[model samples]
Target: MEMDEDPDTLPAQRQGNIIITKYEQGHRAGAAVDMGHEQINIGKYANHLGIMQETELPPIRALEVKQRRKESKRTNKWLKMFADWPKYRNTKKLSQRVYKGIPLAVRGQAWSRLLNIDKIKSQNPGKYKAMKEKGKRSSRIIHRIQLDVSSTLQNHMMFIQRFGVRQQELCDILVAYSAYNPVSIPGQRYSWAMYPYSAWVSPEGVSTS
Candidate 1:
């Protein structure tokens, strides 16, 4: 095939109408519909999992990563030594000392040869699909951390108070995690429900002594 042949014109790379995702080693419970046109299926997921609820999303700063991977404390000590290169370079001849302020261009072919972030992402759909398939068939309990994290009780409070929807949807996330990683919760502690205005009353007469 030619480089610009447009694989969307081909047959095998069509998109499907059904989309389902679930943790590996469990049952399929979450499904989504793709009612739009079936376009190119090169497998793009750059913004698929854009949900920002998790704070551990990887940083996107190149310089930050570079600074982090720098070897010595004195390595970037001269990072700002020639910071004003644009102002000085025109008046003075270019030299190796002003290399810190230089901006480099990234070549597409060079990127393809060096790192393959695209290929790794493109493979996720198949992996997620397979995980859903396996998870639906197997039996297990989800974990407590995921249960708390995915719960609608606190995070989805606005959604519940506004649209009155997604309570079950959020609960399902917790349920899935709870089922996948079940731990023993001893029946010793009692939980309570407090009204918003309950702080006004005094607990002086209600003694537990």
Candidate 2:
């Protein structure tokens, strides 16, 4: 079949320049051959401070992590046994286990027990709900946090779909936690509470965007 003549030279309206091509017609609706699409900014593409990046890896190193994870399963016995607080009160062993990194399956429970989250939760019933209520009332922080949370880890699988379940949960937790600890420098008065707030986007060190 015949192709259209050079679109630039063709007598057409300036705004409606049309160069019909097979690829453009079949796939992208408005990607006319003669249309000049502006190049996206280099900074936007390169400025991935918190975003994950692809990396080449040594097979041996990858295998070692995999092996460690497998061995971590054996430690589940100790992890479960530690739940009985009366029988096990060795802080050093607990610290060592934490340093080794608890298995993902029981990590949440282990952390809760280690941090005495249960005691705090029990002592302050509905405290988390109260913080969430406060967060909802604070429109300014909520708006800002919503915007930031929506963009956080935008390239990751969990966050790729904006406002997805995990993203919403992350946003809620952040907002609630901020309200729970409404202090810029938590350690200013406490002497040892100088912990800066930070978050890890993805467990895997790569963005599968």
Best by lDDT: 2
TM-score of candidate 2 against the unseen true structure: 0.52
TM-score of 1: 0.21
Model 2 RMSD in Å is 17.2
Error of 2 at 209 (Å): 31
Given candidate 1, what's the lDDT at residue 70? 55
The reply for model 2, stretches above 4 Å from the true place, is: 1-69, 183-209
TM-score of each: 0.21, 0.52
Question: What lDDT would each prediction earn against the true structure?
Answer: 0.28, 0.45
What is candidate 2's local distance difference test score? 0.45
Backbone clash numbers for all candidates listed: 15, 0
User: Model 1: residues >4 Å from true position, as ranges?
Assistant: 1-117, 142-153, 156-209
Writing each residue's lDDT as its tens digit, candidate 2 over 1-209 gives 22226565233322111211221233232334212221323233322232323342224467777876786774565566566764555567666777877665465556556666667777888886676556444422444454565566554444544444455455545555666666643532111121111124213211111
